[model samples]
Target: MNNEAANILLVDDEPNILKSLGRVLKNYSVTTANSGPEGLAHALTTRFDIVVSDYRMPEMDGIMFLEKFMAIQPEAIRIIVTGYADLEAAQNAINTLGVFRFINKPWNNLEIINAVEKGLELKRILQENKALADQIRQQQARLNEQDAILKALEAEEPGITKVNWAPDGSIILDESDIDDDFKF
Candidate 1:
């Protein structure tokens, strides 16, 4: 999806962080939630392409919130922004939770915007992959059904489904040999 059409969610206890991030990402549709529960509520009601959360919060930490958020919207790209940056938090966000980006608390405006754009691109790629996979599955199912039909036809009439190709690469059909029920 394009930036203008993509929906982004920002969850942080600080109003300033939310506002600043919202302002920087004004090109896209942005939703802000003050708490983990509030973020989850928004996740239930809306479909967001990306989610950005703060690591430290009163009730639920960013890791916990993002874990629950993933359950709600598995496709949404996740990000954790924290002032208290630690190796453990970064590793957990990346290795376990599949958080796309870990932004420092004193994040550069351009860096944050770049991260959002990259996250959006990842979402688009994933969505396209899913669509292609679905199409491939549907095509495979159709091929299987056709194979079954051909097999049944062959059982009823031996070599009926076999091709009779001429030297000119044209299909040769014997109209008199084919029954009315076999006509295509």
Candidate 2:
């Protein structure tokens, strides 16, 4: 989906942070929450394409909130924006929680917008890969069913499933392979 169509959720205890995030992502379908609880509530009903949250909310930190949120909507891309830039927090957000981005507070508008756009691009690619994998699974199932049918046919009439075509495209059956009672 395009940026305009993508749904984004901004969660922070500070209203100013939420406002700034929302303003930066104005082109997208944006929703703001004052706390993690409210964000979770929104997640329960609406599916967001991306979630940008502050790391130090009162109800729950961004990691905790995102952990629960991921359980609810694993497909939504997760991003943490925090003024508190610590290596441990960044590692946990990226490594443990699978956050897509760790954007710092006092973020430049272009940087935030770029991060969101990249997150949307990642989401789109993942969705496409999932769809392709599903299609391949379905095709493999069909091939398996056809193989079973072929095996059954071979059991009933030996060599019936093997067709030897000559250069002229005519069936060339060996005398030994042809069943005694079989007709052309």
Candidate 3:
């Protein structure tokens, strides 16, 4: 079971809602958390492709949970599952938390599955971009290190004296009489 198949976290205060939605979105690996704190804890420790959180909860609302989750797993796609459709909070959630989608409660089976799939897709793209950027940075660092090593080698070698105007720009010391420090 490769991770690309999509691992999801379903967070809701209602057990029945979680179970029903989990069953509907059975295509992916689903983990259910009954509270915002529990969900955030799981999210911090485990790797999930997407996090689907209910909008209203006792300890924390969906937007609040999403904000904390974003800090831990910025690349994880956050989907709000809520009955409340308050426009102001939804706007804030999008602006601050960067939620991928908002799904209403009593959700249609097909819509939930679709949202999960799309969220996973976005997460994969974000992860891939981050990996590519890291690889580039590492490669650049290696090149810089190699360049420094070459300069150090050039400076230490007595035979390699730079004659700026000459194409083959260097004085070569005779092999036998070379200083011990200049031996390569």
Q: Which model scores highest in lDDT?
A: 1
- Best TM-score among the predictions, by candidate number: 2
lDDT of 2 by residue, 1-184 (tens): 8877899999999988888788788899999999899999999999999999999889698889999999999999999999987989899789988899998878999989999999999999999999999999999999999999999999999878889999999999788875789966
What stretches of model 1 exceed 4 Å from their correct place? 170-184
Model 2, C-alpha of 169: deviation from truth (Å): 1.3
Query: If ranked by TM-score, best first, what sequence of candidates would result?
Result: 2, 1, 3
Which candidate, 1 or 2, would have the higher lDDT against the true structure?
Answer: 1
Q: For every model shown, what is its TM-score relative to the native structure?
A: 0.91, 0.94, 0.74
For candidate 1, the 10 contiguous residues with the lowest summed lDDT are 171-180
Rank ordering of all candidates by lDDT, starting from the highest: 1, 2, 3
Task: Answer with 2 or 3, whichever has the higher TM-score.
Answer: 2
Position 11, candidate 1: lDDT: 100
Stretch of 10 with least lDDT, candidate 3 = 158-167
- Candidate 2 clashing pairs, residues 3+ apart or interchain: none
Residue 102 in model 2: lDDT: 93
Q: What is the Cα-based lDDT of residue 134 in candidate 2?
A: 100
Q: How much is the lDDT of residue 109 in candidate 3?
A: 88
